[model samples]
Target: MRGYAIRKAMQPHRLTLKVWAVAGSFFGSLCFVLFQGGKLALMLFVIVSILSIYLLLGKWSGIRKTAGSRQLMNAEHETTIEAGSSLNVSMHLQIPGIWPIPYVFVKERLFHKNNTEYTYEVTLVPDWKRRGIFEYKTHPLRRGFYTFGKTECVTEDIFGLFEHTGYIELPQQVAVLPQIVPIREWHQFHQMMKGTNHHSTTTRAVRETTQINGVREYIYGDRLSRIHWNATAKTGTWKSKEFERESLPKTFVVLDRHSQGYTEDEQFELAVSVCASLFHYGASRSFALGLVSGGAASQFFEPKHGQQHLKAVTQHLIGVEADGTYPLRRILKEYVQNVAPGSFVTVISPEHGESMLAVLHWLKQLQLNPCHIFVSADPQRKEHWLKSLKSAGFVGYAVSSLAELPVMLGGRS
Candidate 1:
């Protein structure tokens, strides 16, 4: 077992009231034996003193030795998982000592980004080698970054007179990715931009070139001509050469994080899900995707297509919170320089007032195709916003949950 640095200042063995009472009785019996000269009293006092000393010293010495022994603890869990899923964790503890321990109490704590903490307690009975293993499952977790706090192992003597505690620090975290609703066909973009001159510039599908970009695992439908024989022979698996594609159409997803726009946390989560779903759709079709979150700390990513870029975007969404100081109009105006002309911009927010409409108009004037996706749970509000956006010649979608996104974008659920 690996050695762990025990705490320098171990708590001294605690003597409960019973120990003090026994001491007082011994003293009283000794007084009686000395004053009254009773043989039975003297004998009882000697026996009582010896037994008390043996019990107290034995427990104290055992605990002190156990504290200094080699100890190690490890936790196993998934580093990342989808939102609304349960997380399972396994804990293993090793303490090398011969002390007879009745049981060890394990306390676990999980901390969320919002400072919410969940605690679990369990009893572990160590084997002869003083090693213990435990497993636990958490309730369904929401979308966010979660971390495990220090695990506390507490053990006490059989009589419960003395207790000792050791801490195992595990620096582990899990990222719960925002839920993504699969989109079969995204017709809103092309349908709204139809008849516009910029429609010709939009990329509908992946157009491959002869230039080789990289090697990837061979798909079932890949042509034999695209196979990389050298890589396949060396790796003992079919590999296919990936060719470079034509310039992809730039698509930017702007997420609104203004606190006033959302009445509850669920609304903002739905908006985030919408943004993530769009990114997923764009990535699968080879579109250069970017993300712009205008919150307390604004984040901007230029339009790019790659697995690394997608991973970075997903990591950001995992820890995002609604703390924006500015409204949608101001946020767009601040970051307008990063967006390119003739590019598609999708603004996801719950606000659908004149200010939002004006921003969309301004984006159009700047030669950017802008669309609105209003996130809300109220049907009446959604209806009003969709009608207003359509009248202003913009594609708009209303999504209350991830399940409603596919059908709203002209795809079957």
Candidate 2:
């Protein structure tokens, strides 16, 4: 039994050498023997070695009993939490052992799920009993999925000679959801424009321009593709195809997540806030809503109405960053091609670049009503962009902050 205990206790350990203790003890014992003769030296050596060995054996037994026990955790934990919230995890350990660990210390290590960031390590002094239910709390700052990985319950023998670490697997996941903001502007704008509620059929099933109902005389802004070339040539008059809606219409919020799109982090965060607000508003009304964001990987959520779909989208948005491998125009054009015409496309961008210009031009060609919103840090620049957009026959809104969004879109700014 002693041999087995020693082997188990000797598995793996960290040494915290107490230099002062060693040096003092060694010299004191040496001097005692030098002054008091061979008897004192012989007695001191035997007593010290015996006591150290006994302590090692005791530690071996304690750890072997604790680590070798199979059933440790008794309950599961919450797998999700909102950002800026604390998560409390409760765990019960039933290790059949002595009540008190006289001269040993227990330790626990906290780490991120990915193990990329080292959180902290806590040491528990030898207590009356360390075996019981434990409550751990974590405050993760970033909005993303995180988890508690491994808990190392370590114990060091008396005199800090050796420290044995026994790992207890703690597999718990927590998904930190993104911050949601309420959208006061969208509904307020709806009440003013078209003079109807946003939830009404007019806004819900808005007419689509892709479904052609008939052909009519071409207008000045009609694209060549929309012109009936053969008919126009035969009649010597400009004839254009007219398109209408066949299915349910929805609102699609496209966020420009390109690195150069936003002026800074604040602008990008505001864009995300706007998306989240729209998501909440649209989901609550059961309105089919879609989102298109440009980043390292394009995220395109098809228009759908449900709580489940909203959850999935929120999870994606929580980790979404303003880092795009492709131009915002590419992502916009891709989703726009499949979107229903007459559907509201709310384009949120801070920078007015050529890519954005191309998307607007494409939307115009398709006869899709695109509402371009330019979030500006400079008032002068915002007016200039608005003028350029209006001159090109597009509806645009310029706002210094998100608070002014509703008023500007309502034509009441």
Candidate 3:
């Protein structure tokens, strides 16, 4: 691809060389005709001059009209996918006129939020119908929002003396969401907040209300009062009444997006993955889950339990960037009031400095059970930060990768 780009960049110089060669041939033919006085030399000079003029002007006479003509180009791909998943992109181009194009060069550009870019070049030989399709599969893409820039189609004259380029607006967007590690249970949530004033449980097993939502097969520990006699009589098996339990206290996953905290983009990505895993965990168990990011543009999703809510939060995570100018402490200080008392706030960040410790203390003072998930690349540094957080009377977990998150949170793979 690099070589292709280099060759493409030098195409104009190639054209210039072709023009000079044609001019030199024309002058040499003229000199041969003047000095040698041969019929072949006169014929060669006439042919060279006419060919050069046609190549320079006549070949490109209708190029502007061809380019201005409506050309349709569309790119299709999976708009959303989990991180580390490959994406397949299909592009189709329809040229308006049958200008006898030998082939077309298609250049596709994928741009990330951080100004990172990936370029793909493919050659398409238009059929008799003046349409072509090109398909390519990308490598596993990281978690981020990616947009396709305009697709550039370049076609050269049959003689390869001149190039005409046209751009088709693709406007295709793909979002690679942060990967979610399956977590069976988050024991830290239960163990760390055991004696908290607000009732907090790992799952939605809080005190059941009298309103029966449905009935299901009887579990061993179901209370006698919860027996569904009607369901049992109809199904000829033990049945239990399922009640609409009171909503659990909201769990807010605070994603630390301060630019200064992360040494590498991967660390920030790890933090985002942790947050996404927690959201998945909450959604699966019907917990009121929310996301809070204090980045360049602060985002807050109110605690809610539904697929729609999860989708909205996931969309936000897809495009979220670590562009926060303020530290976590200051950002949270401004947004802390939005959180209710007795709520669970899990701060996911790579920073474990005094500033983070201060944020934890502040949250504790506000009656919020604060937990820290420290993301770092260095093992020794992660261990040290975890110890410091533990010593400060905070429940902290260290995670280096998505695979380790389940185990660190007291869940299996």
Candidate 2: lDDT over CA atoms?
A: 0.63
Q: Candidate 1 vs candidate 2: which has greater TM-score? A: 1
User: How displaced is residue 398 in candidate 2, in Å?
Assistant: 6.5
lDDT of each residue in 2-51, candidate 2, tens digit only? 99998777554313344345455666776777787787686896676565
lDDT for 17 (candidate 1): 56
Error of 1 at 284 (Å): 1.5
Over 185-283, each residue of candidate 1 has an lDDT whose tens digit, in order, gives 677664544434343554322356777877766756567788899999999999888677665456789999998888998989899889888888767
Q: Extract clashing residue pairs from model 2.
A: 208-245, 208-341, 211-244
Model 3 misplaced regions, further than 4 Å: 1-77, 96-99, 191-206, 210-243, 411-413
Against the true structure, candidate 1 reaches a TM-score of 0.77
Judged by TM-score, which candidate is best?
Answer: 1
Can you give the TM-score per candidate against the true fold?
0.77, 0.65, 0.76
For model 1, give the 10-residue run with minimal summed lDDT: 67-76
Give the per-residue lDDT digits (tens) of candidate 3, residues 147-258.
8887778888768777787777757677788888888668778554454534544432455577777776675656788899988999999988867757556678899999
Number of the top lDDT candidate: 3
Which residue pairs in candidate 3 collide?
A: none
Model 2 quality (TM-score): 0.65
lDDT of each: 0.77, 0.63, 0.78
